[model samples]
Target: MILDAISSAAGTSSAAKDRAGIADNFDTFLQILTTQLKNQNPLEPLDTNEFTAQLVQFSQVEQQIKQNENLEAITQLAAATAATNAVSFVGKRVSVSTTQSELTNGTANWQYSAAKDADAAKFTIRDSAGKVVWTGERDISKGDNNFTWDGRDAGGLKLTDGNYTLSVSAKDADGETVTVGIAAEAIIDGVDFSGEEPLLLAGDTTIPMSSVKRIHNQ
Candidate 1:
């Protein structure tokens, strides 16, 4: 019965549930052992070795459950600390490694770095619905370059303010594809903890902590 409880506790969905089940089962085992020891016949006494082993098993399971609970508390504490630290990023400018950017006040910006000097470079802007809204050519550079969009389509019509994605393709002098890394910069307006981890609210998009490259002065 104790072994079955241990197995069930191991497969429980949450640490709290597992701890509760383990404690309950451990108590029940102790109660049963106590009762047996109290009512055992003098001629056919409960074997000391067997009861001792059962007590040892209960102790081991209890220790394991306690360790699990401690570790869970530590993890929760770490997550809370991270979320608290993220709050400081609000109102600060942050650069994140992502292809998506939000257009606000008629402008959006992105940063890109080319692996090598490119002979030709093409930039494409796509709306949130994955529709290409604008296309333009950019000057090839060896390293980092910044691109700005004025929230206009290819035909010079203004588009509504929303999230957009920018992609760049470049070819080297020998016609080989040049690798490019894309990023965006924005001010953190708020912190979001509704997800598995905390996210920085940057304009209309949420930036994960892993994606953040740098934080800058506002």
Candidate 2:
């Protein structure tokens, strides 16, 4: 059932793109026909059926394009409404399987795992300037382990609330470096649809729908 829904969405997106392409082609064809008529010799005129057939094809394509655009508009409106409903998540704490914590209300959480039992593990939070604001060592299990940051630097200064990248490194018993990854969950303060695509605004970070693994509340 999940696969079916994904396939349906892909098909719809593709159809919209194809419809836009057809509309563009139709416009180009109309321009060419107008130019041809203007440049045609007065004595030797263009063929009637040829011009009529082209015009008919253009009209048919135009209608199809309009229908496709209407369908797309409906889909966009539905998506926008659904996204707007997600705004209720604001001020509520939730978890999502994602990387890059979108800081909200000066708090964010992430989870990571070790491929093997790490002898040592460290969580490092970096600002946009590539400076490490916070770092801590914690014992972690082989599976997912959650970490939280209060948007503070090592000097105990409260950092301005914003998105920050996290890096984790672990060493196995044999002293081999282990790779660690993180995913953060945030409160959806609002929805952004200023552009052609919709995004979920979790604080300063605008996350795309494609990046959203799951909606927490619903």
Candidate 3:
């Protein structure tokens, strides 16, 4: 009987239900075999090759079913781990590559790269309303320049402590425009892990970890 063969091969009764449900109308095959044996004129019986082929097919199908179940279990485990790791990013300030953002508490920082030596470099900071809030000049060589802006207008008025966008343009000794990289810092309020890679959320923008040049503690 198919049930007997399954029980012997599986080595446990716990999987009997699974094995039995695999074959559709399997009991009908057993009934037909019994009837043929009783009614056959003893001249013909079931062919041996046919019976062997059926047994092999059953074994292959049983293996596939077990493999599928194992795969499902593995997928569930991975999903659980991703959910746990994504929560760890909450409430952390991270440095990511971005052009513009509002500076909270009237303070923001920028990183400047010099392509060539400049006699004088000018840094301009703007507020969220696109108004020039502060301007400063520095004599720097061809290198990095760090500039921080306190929320202030040209009139020397302290703006309200909130988010403000910043834009900077630098000129070299030749009075030609030089390219400078701009970056901002923000607190990671959440993380998204459903995609192929993790994404860090900084206030409103989602930034990939690849764009993160450095990390700092404040």
Per-prediction tally of clashes: 0, 2, 2
TM-score of every prediction relative to native: 0.83, 0.54, 0.51
Candidate 1 displacement at residue 94 in angstroms: 0.7
Ranked by TM-score, top first: 1, 2, 3
* lDDT per model vs. reference: 0.85, 0.70, 0.66
lDDT of 2 by residue, 146-211 (tens): 788898888889888666888888888788888675667766777776776666776677766665
Q: All candidates: CA RMSD in angstroms?
A: 3.4, 12.2, 8.2
lDDT, candidate 1, 16-89, per-residue tens: 66656666766777787788789989999878787677778878867977898899999999998998889988
Q: How does model 3 score by TM-score? A: 0.51
- Candidate 3 lDDT over residue span 1-218, tens digit each: 54456546645544425556655435545565667667867667656576567667767867987987787788778767756655565676666676555566767666666676665566666655677667777765666666677767788888886556555566776788766676777777888776876788776677776677666775
Check candidate 3 and list the clashing pairs.
102-164, 103-164
Q: Which scores better on TM-score, 1 or 3?
A: 1
